[model samples]
Structures are given as C-alpha cells and as structure tokens.
Target: MKRKILLSALLLPAVMAFGQQYGGMWIPTELNEKEMKSLGMKISAKDIFNPDKASIKDAVVQFDGGCTAEVISPKGLLLTNHHCGYDNIQSHSTVENDLLTNGFWAKDMNGELPNPGVTVDFITDIKEVTAQILPGTENLTGAELTKKINENIEAYKKAQKTESYQTISVRSMYYGNKFYAYVIETFKDIRLVGAPPSAIGKYGSDTDNWVWPRHTGDFSMFRIYADKNNKPSEYSKDNIPYTPKHFLPISIKDKKEDDFTFVFGFPGRTTEYLPAIAVEKIMTETDPAMIAVRDVALKTLDEKMRVDPATKIKYASKYARVANYWKKWIGEVEGLKKSNAVEKKKQYEQTLISKNPAIKPTIDGLNQKYNEQAPYNLHKAYYSEVVRNSETLTLAGIYSNYIKAYEEGKMDAKNNEALKARLTEVYKDYDAELDAKVTAKILALYANKTPAQFLPKDFGMLKDANKNLGTIENMSKMSVITGRGNLNGIKTSDLNKLFENPKALVANLKKDPLVEMYGSFKSSYFETTDAKVTALQTDIDALQKKFMAQQMETDKDRKFFPDANSTLRVTYGQVKGSEPRDAVSYGYQTHLAGVMEKYVPGDYEFDVPKKLISLYNSKDYGVYKDKTGDVPVNFTATNHTTGGNSGSPALDAYGNLIGLNFDRQWEGTMSDINYDPKLCRNIMVDTKYILFVIDKYADSKWLLNEMKIVK
Candidate 1:
C-alpha cells in the first residue's frame, strides 16, 4: 500500500471558518494577501516581501543567530531587545566602567563599538519546494525517509544561485510535509551603538520577567557595517555603515487598545500540534523536574550574587538565562492546566479521528508511545540540566572535548588554537565556589530522582562516599582545569602539553575523580541511548508528519499554519489585554507612572536611574507620550510568538515600527504548545518609550536624529 500524501497547508487560505483572528506565523511570500487586506493590513504581500524590490523583509534580520532585529536607518541602525544584546553589553563592561550598570552611548558614528563574531542575516527569498524535496519518497519510512529528504534538501541548496556571501538552506514546515528554501545575505560587522543602564533596560529583572503590566524599557540599538559597496564583510576599520534596501520608520503616533499589530521575525520553536499525552508529560514530569533543578541552582547563585558585586557580575548572564526558561516553564504548566490544554488537545484529536478514521491508529499509537517514553525523556532532561547547570561538570565536558581531540591525534595547531580560545571563553566569568555549590546540590537531586538503571556504575562510588554530594563536587573542582585552587598554579603551556600526549593526558584526567566519574556517566548514558528507543522516536516522527498532513486535510477550509522552527515568519494580531483568571485583568499597556510605582532605591530589580525619576516627575515624555500623557513602556498583544521572536519588530498597519518584541506574558508562555487567544499575548516595548529613553534619558540625540521618525 502506498502512503497518502496530503496537500501542503502553506497554500491554504488565511481566512478560517471559525473566524479566528490573526494567530498563525505566516510566510511572507506565501501569505494570503486577500485575508491580510480584509483583516486591515494596509500593505500588500509584495510590500512585505519582494525579492526584486525593497520591502519590509529587507529590513528584518536574525540578530546574533538567536534573536531578531530590524534596520531602522539607512545607515544600518538596528533595534532589538536590550536583553538580546546583554552579552555584548556585559563584555564591554568593567568594574570601573560598568556598561551594564551605567549604560553606554556612542556620541557619533565613529564612537560605535565593534563586536567580533556578531552577524545578522536577512532573508533574500523564500520558495516553496515541497515537490522537489519530497519527490519519490512515498514508500520510504523512518530513517530512510529522513535521509532521502535531507539528501534532496542538500542537492536543492547546492543548486541554488547565490552570491559568495549569500547562503541557502531548506526548512521543513507542517512537520515534514512541506519545505521552503531560503536565500540569506548575512552581514558580519554588527556593532553596539547604544544601550540603557541595566536598571532601565533590565528593569524589574527576573522577578518581573514574563509577567504582564511590565515597565521594562527592554530595547537596545546597534548598527551593521559592510564593505564600501554595501556588501557583507568581516569587521575592518575601513568598513562603512551598511545602506539597507529598506528601513522601518519609527512611529510615535498614538496607539490604543485593539490597535492592529504584527510581529515579523524568527520564532524559535512551537509544538502547537503535539498529542495531548505529550503535553501532559511535559507539564507533569518534564517541566516540574527541570523547574525544581533550576530552582536549586538559582537559589545558590542568588545568595552569592546579592552579597558580592563581583559575583553578581560573574553570574548575572548565566543566572538570567537559566531563570528565564525556569520561570517560563512554571508559567507554562500553570497556563496548560488553567486552560485545560490536555483536555482540549484530546478533543481536537477526537475531532481529527472522527473526520478520518484512518488517523485513529496513528493518534492512539502516539499516546502510548509518549506515555512509555515519558520516564526516559524525563531522565534525559534531568541529566541535561544537571550537567549544563553545573559549572564544574560543564568544564569537565569541555576538557573531554580536548581529550577526544588528543585521542584522535587531531589536536594540532588549528585545534589547539581553538582550544585555547575555548579556555579563555570558559574561565572569563567562572566562579568556582558558586559552581561547586550548584553542582553538588543539583547532582544530588539528579541521583535521588534518576532511575537506578540509568545511573552510571561509577556513580556507585558517589553513593559509597557517605552520600556526600559536596565530597564529589569538591574532588572535581580541586582537580579539574577550571578549579580556582588548581587554576593559578597551572600554566597555559601545561595544558598545551597535555593535548600533545594522549597517554599522559588520559593519565592526568583520570587523576580527577569528577572527570573520571563524568566519563563513566557519559559512557553509560551513550550505552543506554538504545537504538530501539531511537527507532521508536523515528517512527513517532513519521507518524507525526502524517498526522499533521491529515489535520490539514481534515480542516482544509480552516487556516492551518505551520509551527515555528526558527524560521522567518509574520504573525499579526491586535493590541489586547488578557484576563488570566476570573475577576483579575491586565491592561494592554504600562506607563511611566507604573515604573515609578515599582521603583525601589538600591534594589537590584526595581531600581531606576534618578534621571529617569526626575523625567517622570516632570512628565518629560516629549511627543512620545500617549493620549493620556503617560509614556507607554510596554504593551501586550495577541501575536503568536516564541523564543527567537525576541527583538522582532512590532509593526503597525502601515508597516511602521511601533514596538520591539522582547517577551511573552507569563500566562502565555504555553502559547508554544497550546495557543489560547484569551490568555496568550506577546509583550513588546513601545517605540515611543524607547525613543523617550534614547532622546531624553540617555541624551542620545545623535542616534535619534539618525532614525526616520514619523508622527
């Protein structure tokens, strides 16, 4: 029997029979222009994307490989979330000139700070090539099918006409039912132009992160430079500012509740089409376990950071990165339960099965498969969190990479040069005591939770050592390369020699109890990554793709958008408030008064600069104030967004920049797995407020003058 291949949902109409307003992240080239026009979009599809002409797509970029940014000036002035630029800001910071704390501004173009290795990519074109990608694969299954698809994709990418600086890649949509090839022009000489103090940019900090009614400014400015011909190039003193094909005009016009809004950028990932059983497992087992582990790590780091400023600086980035998803997972669990997402998914599945009984077996098998794999998945999650969260273990893993290089006889000049660079990267912000405390606690939790069969045999040694996690932690730290106790005495040349001799290197590494233990765990973990389990997952993935195709076919008339996979997409909605629970509601937008209300002097999270307070007191918002005479800080909308959408541009009907995407409301974090129109909302910093800070607070008039402002 031949496998059934369903129609591609990317070609479906945007209008839904259920009258659901703008929820899907649409491909600009494949968008239903009529639906957009009917829904009050002022621009045509071509106006958003036109390879042969300058359009909105030309202005958007994937910032630093993780976030999104938009060019706002012909000189390549880019706008993105402050947190997205946090690492760059922190790198330029020092004890004396703490840019993270005090902020930095370039007085002129010549003052802009160049960042090494930072790059921004713009999509030049997107072409639907499902036919080409999936040709003659109807009879294949599992890895064979995947291998063919990848091979086809590689062939297609290689055949594309691209410049030396441009690149091509293929992305799967609708699970694997559809494929779109993208041509991207990437600029490498991105520079830091200006950023507000942490007090303003990261205002409210972790405590208020992912929560609504937010007052965080959460905006940063940068510039992209190119060679004289405006082509992408490596950073050079002779490079000139990139003159973009298109730049978003800053809108300081008043925006009210129900204002039409859209976010255009990359959204990292979303499993909007998962089975109910998977959602349950994530909520019940994975989320809670991961959250608990992170909770322990956060407590340790927070305690140290509060007492010591140096420790605070050392752990700030790591703490924020960990806490972000920790808080999001907590909210996701809450939202999933609050909205009864599992029950809803089951209902949808029933409807799907009813529409086509052919899918019933697939759906039933998926539920059983998810249930059986739940523990194994949770075990993997726990192990991942334990190793990744522990600085000592992370260092061990880093050294393990070098050991492999030595054993392979690949630790020559190039690899050694890279290893030296890696060492510098590792030890720069490392805190040994903090790592030891975090590692000890987290490893103990993992041992307590993980099943015995999954535990490495060498872990028995830890159990025999009086069940003392600290003992294991201390032994590792004292002997590992990153251990402060051992660090100062060990020279760089010593590490160089270790890499030169595989036998001596193994001997030296074996002397460290933690290293040896980690080696055992890694080896044992690899042993347990059963091929059968992998085959089961591969079967599940193939089933999922079929299920996705069936879903599109069953709901052919309804708008079926693909899930986010770190691809450029356009999601539009209205500025709206969410009633998370009965009798409690959040307004759509926050104001300067709210910032002042939350202000606490000398408090790490809530403190604002005195200059900001004075401006608020004087109502010095200039023309950026809303109709009510308050500067809008941040606003919420029904736009469907996820991780990589951070720093995406929030555009108005006319495609003018009004806000910068930074986060989603806490209750809406579940939007990734399940989207609820009432509860789901993305939070964005109002461009007016960004302008107010740049022009008034930061006194960045020159930067303001560079942007194209529209009232």
Candidate 2:
C-alpha cells in the first residue's frame, strides 16, 4: 500500500505536466503561472491581464461580434483575418472597383471606407459572480434553478456601478459551477484601412482552408473611431481615431520549432467534457446529415458559378460560408474516428466509475438520455440545414413572422420600416433562378434522409414519384417567393405593395405556396420534435452538470479548465508541427516559394498578381524576408483554438505579436470535442508576411510607420 501510494503520487504530477504542455483554453485570471514560466513565458500573468492597469487584454477586442482583433497602434490600428472582414469588404465591392478582386489601400485616413453596422467590443473587466448567483438555488433542480439564477444575475447587473459606455453581460462557466460577468465597451465606428486581393488574402480559397503549410495571407486592417472625448459613439464626421490603452508591438525576429507561443482571444464554443455516447452521436449522425445536404447545394452552386462571372461575384461569400463548414465537418468525422475519441472517452468513464461507484448511475443515465435524443437531434440538424441553406425559404420565414405580428396587432411603423430594409438587403445579392435549383436539390435530400414520422404533413407533395426535383421546380414556377414559374408570384419590387394592405397581405401570403410549405415544416418541427428535444436536453444538462462535479470530486489531483463559451481565454503551446498519420509529416512553416509552386495563371483559386510575381522574381522581399532568404507565409503551433479564435494574436515570450491566428489544421478541427496535441495544430500567418504585404505589395509603408516594429 505504501508503494502504491508513492507510485500514484508520482503519476499524478506527470499527468498534470502532460496536460500543461498541450490542451487547455485557460482563464486569464486563473493562470497556471508556474507551468507557463516553465514553458518559457517571460511575462507575468498580471502583464497579460490586469484589471487595475493597462495590459494586453485592453488591446484585444471582439471584432464585429464574431471574431477577435488586436490593436497594433495607439491610433487604434486593428488587425484581424481577411475572412472576418469579408462581409464588409464585399459590401463595399462593386463591379467596377471590386475591392475583393483588386484589393484596397487607404492612402490617407480620409480614404478609409466606413462600415455602417460594424462594431468592435473591448472587455474592460471580468469578475467571478458565482457566489452571488448560486446562493439562493441550493435545493432547486431544472427550470426553477435556472429561473432563480437568471433573476439573481439581473439583480447583480443592476446593482453594479459602471461607466455610461460600459454594458454588463453574465456567462455561466464550468457547467453552472461558476459564473463570470464581463464589462464591455463597444465602439460603433469602424473603418476598413486595407486588405489584400483575393489572390493573396484568400490564395487557396476552399481547397487549402483548413490544411497546413498554408500560403494564404489571411489578414486585413481596420481602424476604430470615436467621439471627441474618445468615448463610444455612433458614426459621425467629427469623430477621431480612438487611442488605445496598450497595443502589441510586432516581432520580426526569426522563429524556430519548439519556440514557446500562446493564443489570446474569444473562442466561440467547445464540448470537451461530453460523454462517449454524445461524441459518437456527433461523429456518426449529426455531421454526416449536414454534410450530405451541403454537398448537393455546393455542387449546384459550383457549376453555376463556373459558367457565369456575375453569378460568381454574387455567390462568392455565400459559397465560402457554406463550403467552410461542409469541409470542416468532413474533416471532423475523419479526425474523431482516427483519434479513437469515443473509445478513449469510454475508458476514461470506466476509470471514473471505478474510482467512485456512486457516480455510475449518473453516467449511465446520461448515456441513456443521449441515446434517446439521437433521432430528434438528427431531425433538428436536417431541418436547420434545409431552412437556412435555401434563401427562398429563409425569406418565407421572415414573412411568416411579419404575418404573425400583423395578426397579433403588434405591427407598427418602426417594424414595417425594419422589414422593408431587411428585404432590400436580402434581394441585393439574391438570385431566384439559382436558389430555385439549390432549393429543389436540398429539399429532395431532406425528404429522403429524414424519417417519415418526423416530416411535415404535406411533405409528400414536395416529391413526385420519389423524385423531388420536377415537383419542386414546378412549385417554384408557380410560387410567389422565387418569382420563376409564372408572373403571378411576388416580385422583388412588388413586396412593398403587399405591405401597404396588412389584412389583404396576410391573406395572400397565407395562400402563397412557398409560405405554406415553410409553415408546414416549422409547425411539424415545433409541435412534434423540438419540444421533446428541449425537455430531454434540460434533463441531460442537469445530469451532465452533476457528472462534471462528481468527476472533479473523484479526481482531486486533476486540473480542470472550463469549456469555451465565446469568452476571453488564453491557450498556450509551442510552435511545432506533427505527423498526423504514418509516413506523412508536415513542416512547421511554409515560405513564399510554396506560393509560386501552387500558382496558376487565370485560375480562380491560385492566380498570382503580376506585381507580386515581378517582386518575387527580383527577390525584393525587403525586411520581411526570413533568415533563410524567403518570406515566411504561415506557421503551425499547438494552440487549442476553435471558430471564434479567428484573427487572435499569437504572442511570443514577452507578449509581443509573432503571428496572427487564423485556421486550424484539418485533423485538429475535432479539438472542439477532444483535443490531442499530436493531431491538433492551429495555423497562423507570420507577422513578417503581413509586413511584406503592407510595405512591398500594397506600398502602404506610411501605415507601417504607426506600428512599433522589433527586429
């Protein structure tokens, strides 16, 4: 027994050391300072995040509510992924001056283009409020407990003292075991400064998106503007560039493999603690269903885009949005299977139950609940994919809400204006002919895949002789949504006329074929599947929370980090590469030479600009060239990141910017569920490459003078 105890104690430290070396999205306040120092972090935890003074956290902001961005200069020069800023860029693009194709560089501050609805939020403070939130709900379970906690949060937010510019938001962590409130300041006026053309910014396009050894210069620049007092305000001509508390200095020093690195940003979501059964469900049923539906949509779009340049421009952003996840899901299924995540999870569960037999019931109950919820989960996935992917159906859903509001006597002038504005935006880049084709294919797939019991009452009417295309096309010709079949359906210009007569409009819309079809699908989902899924999910969540607590209690030696909930986090690791499979090794970085090797003239995905080629031939890389006499495009690191980590800052030992985090290796996409350091590596664009593009490529050297560059 003495020997066994000694051996167990020794093994505990080794296990913790392994965890420290690789996987974890840690909270900045609760950092493992000792381990970080051991891993070569020269700066202290306080230097990274200090609430009382200026620190690194002050420079990082949530870009437009979806991705992360870092301030690079005192004048509020911001850096983020090109894809994060793609929507704004596309918005400013025209057939004559297509910023997406020709790129854009603001020669002076006055030339910077304004983005109307874009905003960036800075997290000023984060404080743990678990003590206040959980005190009154000790005996409560399920909905009652949730209701009381929300009430407590509302009271806490009202009681806290904050500045007029600050807004308070509360988020649950560790599955409700802890809660943190964030004080955020949002800046309304953000403008685009510069971006590389698609040939450079999106070099590989969809083909090399999640792959390593990437040559894409996936970075863009924006600036934040504020009122005269440097406070958050809506856009106006009098506003000036806001001064930031602290900005990251760029490091152009040559880096090597095994160098220490860390990523700081807000990661959207992850399910790292789910049981084996739940992981299996995601791998087998959920991902495959979504993939199949998107496959049809992509094939149709790809064929259409190749034939018509106008269509290509209209659908470029939409295609990227769809293809991004379609490929990610494919890679995730392969990664989960390759990593044997489910089996490993089962073994871990066995150990947990072996350590404390009392928790066996909880684990078993959770697994059973997941098994019962699998079918409903699949139905939900198919429904969401079908509804969201079809533009016509999406518009139908919007009109459905308008009809409901008019019937409920809730429609006002403000709501009518908002509806008109939304419809105009939707129809701007919309193609009814293309949507009709995509809708017919996706609807057919949905009918074939989803179980008959869960389908809508008139689902059969969508299919003719087991082939949905002809029937769907016929409906499209006659329906008012697509405006394709006959001239009787509503046109884009005719929508405003319908809104003039509320009662008649509702009556006509209720009779419209597309609106009726959408209503059937939505009604069936809400009445039959969604309610059951929600009830089971509530029970499952309660059980999972209990299971999480039990695991913590049973394994006192283990260190736990909360799952990402779109909150600020810090994940540290080394700049390294991996052998994802036998006989297939990947390098740590890719150089400019790799770009030339992949270049193809007049190709949509691989075309290189003439000026860039001339510069490359002359070897005029300036100060951005690496020690090896080549410009480093991208590098791989072992940072655990996910969706919202896009455009996060990859920092060096002294907290200087070394690279910009963009994409994860394809195999590592599964890190959202199970993280393996060997298989998971986040891809980043080298800062040197960013500098080269700004100085040599775009000839925007004046903007570089605002930055603090360290050689």
Give candidate 2 regions above 4 Å deviation.
1-21, 90-97, 113-117, 226-240, 303-314, 424-437, 458-466, 485-490, 497-505
Assess the local accuracy of residue 85 in candidate 2 as a C-alpha lDDT between 0 and 100. 95
User: Each candidate's lDDT (Cα)?
Assistant: 0.83, 0.87
Candidate 2 structure lDDT: 0.87
The per-residue C-alpha lDDT of model 2 at residue 371 equals: 87
**Which lDDT tens digits does candidate 1 get at residues 199-312?**
999998877888877889888889999999989999999999999999999999977666777899999988988888889999999999999899989998999998999899
Model 1 regions more than 4 Å off: 1-22, 32-39, 90-98, 226-230, 233-240, 302-314, 420-434, 458-470, 473-505, 530-533
Question: What lDDT, from 0 to 1, does candidate 1 have?
Answer: 0.83
Point out the worst 10-residue segment of candidate 2 by lDDT. 1-10
Question: Candidate 1's error at 640, in angstroms?
Answer: 0.8
lDDT of 2 by residue, 260-344 (tens): 8999999999989999999999999999999988998999899999899999988987898899899899889988999899999
Score candidate 1 by TM-score against the native. 0.89
